[model samples]
Target: MGNFFFVRDYCSISVLPGASLTIGNNVFFNNYSSINCLDNILIGDNSIFGEGVKLYDHNHKYGFNPEFSIDKTDFKTSPIVIGKNCWIGSNTVILKGVNIGDNCVIGAGCVIHKSIPPNTIIKNGQNLIFESLQK
Candidate 1:
């Protein structure tokens, strides 16, 4: 644990034997958030993650092949990077290969599966919208 890093109770951080989870200084994670790191999950400094947020760096390979059963299917791994001073709202799910830039705000219940630019704000409802904070 680094300086000023705080993870609330009941938060689950599962890192595979060969994988890495690098969390920077002053990173705060709320309760009940689950981080499943199979490859790498780099969370930058001063980032705040809300409750029930889920971060996953790998996903089951569910391609068209029916030969392998669901449990036998391999996991496709990727890295997830959240930049400095970002705010991830509650119940948000960040998927594999996502690179979120600095000072970004992710609204509640957002399922992020793509990269976001710097100083961006993402709000999710019936639809998701991206607003740039940079002029």
Candidate 2:
């Protein structure tokens, strides 16, 4: 965690053993936000996570096997990176191996599983749309 990092009401963060979570300066998490990091997660300076934003650096690993059962400790993990000045909107879910660049805006209720470049605006989460950030 960096200087001036703050989490508002009900924000939760979990870092598993041997995992790395690095939060930069002036980062903020709003109400009901959560981060489950099993591998690595980095939040750059001046980033803000909106209400109910959820970030995960790992996903449950599963395969179709007759004798296989759900294993709570089995997971596939990667790093999640949010660059500086980014605003992740309410109810957004950022999955593993996602790298969001600087000055980006992700709209509400979006599920992000891919990398986003700098100066981008993501909107209309139900289907999803993208625009270059103006100015």
Model 1 stretches with alpha carbons more than 4 Å out: 66-69, 127-135
Summarize candidate 2's per-residue lDDT along 25-101 as a digit string, tens digits. Answer: 99999999999999999999999999999999988887668776666789999999999999999999999999999
Q: Which lDDT tens digits does candidate 1 get at residues 40-115?
A: 9999999999999999999887654557456454799999999999999999999999999999999999999999
Candidates' C-alpha lDDT: 0.93, 0.94
Q: Give candidate 2's error at residue 87 in angstroms.
A: 0.5
lDDT of 2: 0.94
Candidate 1: give its CA RMSD in angstroms. Answer: 7.7
Instruction: Judging by lDDT against the true structure, name the best candidate.
Output: 2
Root-mean-square deviation of every model: 7.7, 7.4
